[model samples]
Each structure stands twice: as structure tokens, then as C-alpha cells.
Target: MKLNRRTVLSGLAAGSAVLAAPMVMAQGAPRVVVVGGGAGGATAARYIAKDSGGAVNVTLIEPTRQYYTCFFSNLYLGGVRDMDGLGHGYGTLAADYGINVVHDWAVGVDRDAKTVALASGATVPYDRLILSPGIDFKDGAVPGWDVSAQSAMPHAYKGGSQTELLKAQILAMPEGGRFAMVAPPNPYRCPPGPYERVSMVAHTLKEINPTAKILIVDPKANFSKQALFEEGWQKHYGGMIERIGPDFGGENVSVNPSEMTLDIDGVVEQVDVCNVIPAQKAGEIAHAAGITEGDWAPVNAADMSSKMDEAIHVLGDAAAQGDMPKSGFSANSQAKVCANAVLGALTDSRVFPAKFSNTCWSLIAPEDGVKVGASYEATEEKIASTGGFISETGEDEATRAQTYQESVGWYAAITSDMFG
Candidate 1:
């Protein structure tokens, strides 16, 4: 079956049991604890809670009271979206679905004891643990940069404050100033994120500081939707953006956040703003749980179960699942598959076949959006791609506008799917 948004929702509703009344917990119900309340965790928590019909106790551990999405954050940077529009609270999940939404940091995980230790000195025991802690920057991935320099050179990879800081810095740049972005290597969260960010930054600068220039110091030879993004950049922001690839020593780079300088292959240039997107790995709790292989936690393709522990499932950007890019759509898709498996394991629910789909939409200019997506199924080795589609370059204005509209609708649908 085609695993589109509507299909996913309908299939879930048909396969799972009806939603149980709030606070109706069965005696000795199995407890499921989910860490990181972003796309994967929140969706997983909501699905399990709603589907189990109070047959399982669900507790979601997220540090933030208001969860802001990393997706579409670039639109906020570009003034297309507001900051308030990006944040979502878990009140509905708590009051409506009867989930225990704990706003506390999950500092450590004891897989042996099936407990998660929080910063509040509380140990929350779980029969099943779902980790969707998202990506954390790999230390020393970008030379001369660390968390200490975030204020001066914000990564802005994470949502919320860092995004605000980066946009603020952009607005504060001097006229004709240079904005440099150090793109991360492959296997980072959101492959099109940096490019879309460049597009949004260019969009912002063209209005306020028309003479400002943008530089991309990219380590990779090619990037996601390269042809489409390059085409849009030339058509919209010509002569304002320059990219240096590995051939031009873009791979050998360093930054001085204090001085606001970017050094490319021994050539240092003054820059007004530097957005460093470093190589990323699974969040710290995954490592603490000893489930990570190298940088990411490997999971079984059928259920997103961690290779190290069957009781633990790793989802989203943190999991080294094959074929699927690290994206919010992908995470949300994986969450449904995982939720079905977890529901079956815990509550004896009817589990559907594991199918996944992802579509990444990027807004190059106002009402000009392009998308790439694929369908996948579980294989013995991984979640292998089966078929795909992409927005072709040189599409008509009407087509691009329609794509943009589709993206807007998707955002609304997904946020509702996640938060509600």
C-alpha cells in the first residue's frame, strides 16, 4: 500500500484499537518511556498511548516545555514564518491522551534495569524504551569551534534559541558584509537544511542588505537537490552567493568566532556571520545506553529496535537506518512503524507491515518550493527504498506555487499529527 499521509493515518486508525478515555490506566499496565519529544518521540508516544487504549502506561521525557521544530525554522529566519508558529506544547498529549509528559532532562539510561535517570534524580522504569533524541554535534568535527562559540557562530542546527541567535546576527550584519556557512559532512540531520538555510538567508539579505554576499564552505562534492537549489539561487539571488566545494579547498576550513573570520585552506577572510553545521552523531543518552555503533545507533529495519537491546528502539536522526535521510518526515514515518511494533509487543495489538515514506520540501523563494520523496519497505538489512519522486527543475510558476502550498498544508497536518 502507498504510505502517504492519509494512508498512514487511515491505516493506523483501522489497525489499532480505539483511543481509551483519559486517565484510564489498567492495573499493572506495561510502561513505555520515550525520550526526546520531537517528531519521532512525540509521534511514537502519542501513537502508543492512543492505540493501546490504556493497556500501556506512556511517559514522554522531554527537556523542553515547548517543543520547537527544526523543520521550517529556516522560514522563520527568512521572515516567511514567525517564531511563535514554530513552538508546540504537550498539553493536549497530557490532558487528552493521558500521557505522562515530563519536562525533564534524560541524563542517563540504564538498559539493564530498564530505567531512565533524569536530572531531577528520578528513575522512571519502563518495560519498553523509545529513544528519538535527535542529532548532537560531533566534538572537534569543525576545527576551532565548539559549543562555547555558539553565541558568536551559532550552529542553529537545533531549533529555538540558536535559530533566533543566527537570525539576529544576520539582521545585525554590516552592509556588504559576508555571511559564511560551513556545511557539515554527509549523514547529518536534514540534508537539505543547510542549502535551504542559505536560500532563506539570501532571501533575508536581499531585502535589507542588498549588497551583502553569502559564502558556502562545503566539504561534500554534491548535496541534496543541488541542481534545483543552484538554479533557484542564480535566478533569485544572482551574484550574491558563492560556494567553494572540496575542489577549491572548502573541505579544509576553520573559523575564529571571536574575530569573525573564516579560514579556507590557509586563506582567512573576515565574515560578519558564520553558521557552522558540524558533523553530528546520536544524542548522548544513546551513547550512555551503549547502543551506538560509531556515530549513530543501528536499529533493526522491521521495528526500529536497537541492535544492542531488543527492549530499546531508536528512531529518527539518531538511528543509522539505511536509505532514509535524516529528516522530520522520515522520523515521523519511522515512528508509526515503531509504534505499531511496540503496541503489538506490549498490548497484543495487530501490527501492520513495516512501510515508510518521506518527502522533504524546500522553499527556495516565496511560493517557490521543490520536493523530493521516496517510499520504502523493511528488508533484512535495512529500510530499503522502493520508489521515489522529485520536483523537476524549470517547473512553471504555477507548479512551484502548488508545491509550496502543499508544503504549508503538510506542516499543519504533521504538527497536528505530532502534538495533538
Candidate 2:
């Protein structure tokens, strides 16, 4: 019991052991819960699990077992891709990484408790929460249009079965018949998406029914890549696609799904197919979670951490981060930054600076594609674009063809990155 050098060393080692045990357990036991299995949530969940090496528990909450990319569904409609090609499941997320794949709706989020309430009546607690629930339509924004009428006039914005449904309606159009679209307002998911769908529909119609007309009643004066799309439509599907902007009464529009009539600019017309892309807001779960200020959840651009709740990170289309388009690529980029930040908070891991990028390619015709992209860096205020590129308006066929190929490669790569 004498205070010798050996005894003093033994006492110091015991003290160090008692202090280290709690820190080790705390680092290993952190839980991350992701609601929505789309680009942002899926990528974040996978990275947090895979990179952490089983040190953190990850759970993915998604309603659908099979997910389809909204990015390429237009190609599927135009016969450039297939439905099966667009479909991805959570099997890889579970099998390869030990993520808890919960195929249930995230009905509620208790921010105070840092827990998610699923439709199955179970609550999953989390040290960090990631919500990337995408977009939802504003109810009754268009007169005589709502979720109940989605079947009669499909938006096809969410991809999956809706894309298939819209394609079916387009295919069954009468020869020389009219196809009308009520394009969504600005700040919707994929700003160029509606125009791309028009191009794809025209591509299909050119093969089957050359005389068929596609009309777009758009609320916005200008759309993403407006000049490029307009030139392509004229060159490829001449006299087939007519987009009526706000000056032409695109703003004031109403649809009667039952009668198959579209009213634009105080003129009512009967159409063979009516596709209504309504004004949108963040998904309902964001509202349920009380994280949204208006239509979108505000977040710290550097890490995608919610301003309303630091425990939650809002991403993808649900997040209101400036200068980043709400595309799959942007979501995936944000997710990686978020994963690093979350892991750092949980396990004291190294967190890198956030750099994000996105490129959206629209196929005008088979083998002809155009793209717009930008590289962004996290700033104190927002994720600001530093550099960007876009395909030229009059690019040669070979150049356009290469862009299309690049898109195909991107699709394959991103899908693998997200699911696997």
C-alpha cells in the first residue's frame, strides 16, 4: 500500500480506463434515421452506415419498396429507357450495408424527442434525422384538379407508376389528336422537366402519329433551357409542340378531367390527353415535422442542417438551399456532405468541406441530348455556384450524341451510388 512508482502507475491507468469507456460507447451507439429513400436520404443513410463501419445505426424510412428515378422517366416515356431500368429497391442498402430498411411512411416527426413516427405505429429514435421527402402538389391550386384527379390526368412528376400512367395515356391518343399540359409554376422539382416531357411525348408521337399536337400552358414566362428546348422542338418535332407562356394565358388555366377539357386564356378546348403539373410545396412530412417556414425547410447550406431543428437535416427538394436546383445529383451531393457532418458530430470523424454539383440532361430525340450543370461550394450564406457549363444550342449531332451517352452513364453511376 506504499506510494511507490509502480502503484502510482497502476492508479493512473485505472483512472484513464474509467474515463475512456463512456466515450467509446457513446461514439459507437449514435443512431441516424433517414425519412424518404430517394436520392438524398438513401445516399446519406448508405454513406453513414458504410463509412462508419457499423459504428452508427442507420435506418431508412420509405413508403415504397421500389423507387424510380424522376430524372430518366421521360426517356422511358419516349422509349429510350424501360420501366424496369428505372426501378431500384432498398435490397442493396440492406444487404451490402447493415441499414434498417423500413418500408413504411414517415407519418410524423417529434423534433423534441428526435424520433420519427411511422405509419406502422412504431417510433424510431434518432440522434440525427435526415428528411428528403421531395415535393407534394399544392391542393386545388388549379381549379378542378387535386390528388383525386391525378389518375384521370397524371402529373408524371413523381416518376414510378405515374410515369407509366402518363405514357399509356399518350400512347392511346387518337391520330392527329391534341395533348395538353398544364406545366407547374417556378421552383418546382426539375425546372426543365415539363419541357423534357413534352419533347419525349413528341418523340413518341412522331413515330406513331406524326400529326399529333402537344400544347403546353406554362405559368412561367421562361423555363430551364428555354431557348434550347424551343429550338429542339422546332427542329425535331416541327409544328408539333406549342408552348403558351404567361402572355398567352398560361397563368389562368383550368382543367376538367372528366370532360377531358383544358381551359387556357379564357378559351376552352377538348384534348385527348391532359397532363397537369400543379404548383408544389415540400412533401407533407416536412409540414408534419414543423420544419418548413413556408413551402420549404430552411437549412444551413454548409451541412444541410435544419435551421428550425439542429438534430434534423433537410435535403433534396424539401430544402430551401439557394443556388442549387432540386435535382437528383444535387441531392446526392448534399447527402455526402451531410453524412460527413453527421458522422463527425456522432463519432468525431473527419468532416470535409461541402462541394456540390449537378448536371441535368434532357433527351430531345433518340441519341440527342442537352445538359446544364453547375459546381457549387458551401458559403456562409448559401451554397453558391462557382462554375458551370451547358451544351450549346447548335451543337453537332456527334456532340449531342455524346451528351446523351454521358447522361446514360450518369444514370447508371448515380443509381449504383444511391442503392448500392
TM-score of each: 0.95, 0.93
lDDT per residue, candidate 1, 1-420, as tens digits? 667878756754674343644435788999999999999999999999888878889999999999889999999999999999999999888877779999999999888888999999999999999999999999998889999999999999999999999999999999999999999999899999999999999999999999999999999999999999999999999999999999999999998988989889999989999999999999999998999999999999999999889999999999999999999999999999999999999878898999999999999999999999999999999999999999999999999999999999999999998988
After aligning candidate 1 to the native by TM-score, how far in Å is the CA of 323 from where it should be?
A: 0.3
Which digits, one per residue and each the tens of the lDDT, describe model 2 over residues 56-133? 888899999999889899998899899999999988787657688999999999888888998999999999999999
Candidate models: Cα lDDT each: 0.94, 0.89
Supply candidate 2's per-residue lDDT for 356: 92
Off by over 4 Å in 1: 1-22
Q: Which residue pairs show backbone clashes in model 1?
A: none
Compared with the true structure, model 1 gives a TM-score of 0.95
Which candidate leads the pack in lDDT?
A: 1
